[model samples]
Target: MKKILVTGATGQLGSSVIETLLKKMIESQISIITRIEEKRVQFQAKGFNAFRASYDDVVSLENAMEGVDTVLLISSGDQGDRMQEHRNVIDTAKKTGVKHIAYTSRCLNNRNTLANKLMVEHFETEDYILSTGLKYTIFRNILYMDAIPQFIGGNIALERGIFLPAADGKVSFALRSEIGEAMANVLLSEEIENKIYNFTSDKAYSFYDIATALTDLSGKTVKYTSVETNVFEGMMKQRNLPEPVILKIVDFITDIKHNQEAGIFNDLEIILGRKPSGLKNGLKTLFGL
Candidate 1:
């Protein structure tokens, strides 16, 4: 059996991708590479093969990818030194002679905005992956609708109903399950090598629409308050959010709301061969409504 290894299996996207792959492929043929042993155990209990690995450690990565047919490098969440971390994984995969390499990247490759960090990293990653002369697929994932609950919970805790710096800009946020299926399709298919798959929902919506969705789902009068970037930063500070983190986050939000770069794509539906889940269905599952 050919083994397909997934790095960062503890993360939301990675875990979902692994589950989707195993459901389609044999359990023994799917592997999870993670830094945490507990997470590995969870995969083992689910009848998956797990390997302890990290992006920073080249040797561990090589060992994890050893004899594996395909690899899905879920981009690291670490802000600092992430590029080097990704490079290490790519180099290790090359050395291990993996058949196909797939990466989860940002929605757009334009570097004209602050929300383009992932885009930059992904472009670099794609370049490096191609340089290795291996069969590769780049999944340029859009914003996830799974983030709604977290944003809503934070707003409620801060007593700031639908608080954000974004104005009328729409984000092409995709459902986790939809992305999972698309990734699985790419991983399982042998015909898509040397392809760049831009995975996003067919539609886009502003945060105000998000707030309205919440209100409609739970009957909570959540108001969309578009504050100035500085004002939003101050609000986060008032809520005792860490200074450095809030500064970066506020700047990202400012870019989106200011129309620096924001829109939707039909890539998800194209890849999955079906209509991707929308914001309402995503919220329904998230809120259990």
Candidate 2:
């Protein structure tokens, strides 16, 4: 049987892709590269092929990719030097003579955008794959909406009949599961080739749209407050969040306020051969409303 290797198998995205793949093929043919030894028995019990590897360690990568025909590299979340880390995997895959490698990238490296910083690194990784003259596909995923959390004070406000933090900026949020399914389709479909696919839901919504949904479903007077970036970060710090994480959150919000652009809707539907799920549905799933 041809082997398909999935890197970062213990991660959220990697784990979902492997689950989807198993629905179509036996786990024996699905190889997972991960450093966590505790998951080895779990994968073994499920009949998956597992290998011990690390992106920072080239020898570990080469050994993992041995005899693997295809590789699905879920981007490393290690924001520090991610480009070089991804290069390590790409180089090892090439050395192992892998036929096709699929990379999880972002949509549109549109030079002037803040998303560009994130997008460009993925592009660099894409460039490395192309340089090797290897067959590849790119799954450019959008933001996942399921990861949102209610602010700490929002609980008291909800009890007091006041919902807060109505961000006015528009957001194009897609479910991670949808992206996972599309990645699996890309891996399995023969019709797709050396090309790039931008994965997003059909609708792009603003923060008010989310607020409106929350109010309608939860029957609570939830409010969306548009606060300055500094204020938001200060509040998070006051709540005892770590400085580094708070800074990342602040930077992310600043990006959203200034650079959250309208996203492409067709690529995801076309790839999956179905309509992508809507934000309302996602909200309902998350909030039980």
Candidate 3:
């Protein structure tokens, strides 16, 4: 079995990938990078070859990358210099003679208009990996259906209804867990090289559609109110949300209005071998209806 090292091993998507890989193959074939000693020990207990590494630290990355045949570079969070961290990972992968690399990027393929500043990192990372002379697969994942709770306030979502500045813009959302499972299959297949996939649901739905789904599932009258940007921000602030969190919520709504978040491609369905989860079912599951 080839040695496959996975970065972001403690994250939701990374954990899903690791779990699926362990089920499909032997533990010796999988390796995980985690800087936390407890997480490393937990993975070790599961018989995985867990290593200590951080994306920003080249020396640590080099130490963790030894004997890694393929590396899955799960993009780091938006905090700090994420683009530089990605560069370090790419450079280290090449230096350590890793044969194949896979990166999880955001939805949409156009470099025309980016959803946000951090999205630029995904596109730039794509360019950087293509320039590395290494075989690579890129998954341009869309908004996760699982993130609906966060997008709208999880606990008071039904009571609050949907209040965003995105207007009627539609989004193609898929569950992150299912996407992660499909990604694992792509990583293990050497045949899926040098390709970029748009990981999105088959249909695009607006917040209005989302509200309808929630209403049908929760038996509550959920309203979709497309307010002004400032109005939405003020609402969040009144709820005692921090500035950064308010900014993120506004950005997501703005991105949706700009058409950067909506996707119509079925690349994910092709990989999953079935229709991706629709809004009604996803909402039902999420809200425990």
> TM-scores, in order shown?
0.91, 0.89, 0.96
Can you give the lDDT of residue 288 in candidate 2?
69
Residue-by-residue lDDT tens digits, candidate 3, 12-49: 99988988887677887888899799998988898888
- lDDT value for candidate 2? 0.74
**Local accuracy of candidate 1 as per-residue lDDT tens digits, 1-289:** 6689888788778767877777669877887887788887887888877878788888888778878888888888756688899898888878888888889877752655556354566677778888988888888877778876665454362244776778786777888778978898778765655887778777877888887887787777768887777787787789798987786676556666655435566767877888988888887787786
Writing each residue's lDDT as its tens digit, candidate 2 over 1-289 gives 6679999888888877877888778988888877788786678677877877788899988877888889899998755689888989888888889988899987642545663255567777877888988888988787677654443243353444422233554557788888888898778775547988888778777666776777777788766677765777777778799998776665555455553534756887886788888877887886667
Q: TM-score: which is higher, 2 or 3?
A: 3
Ranking by TM-score: 3, 1, 2
- Candidate 2 residue 61 C-alpha distance from true site, Å: 1.2
Give the worst 10-residue stretch by lDDT in candidate 1.
Answer: 151-160
lDDT of each: 0.76, 0.74, 0.86
Instruction: Provide C-alpha RMSD values for all models, in order.
Output: 2.3, 2.7, 1.4
Deviation from native of the Cα of residue 40 in model 2, angstroms? 1.6
User: What lDDT score goes with residue 113 in model 1?
Assistant: 52
lDDT of 1: 0.76
Clash pairs for candidate 1? none
Q: Which candidate should be chosen as best, given TM-score against the real structure?
A: 3
Q: Which stretches of candidate 3 lie over 4 Å from their true place?
A: none
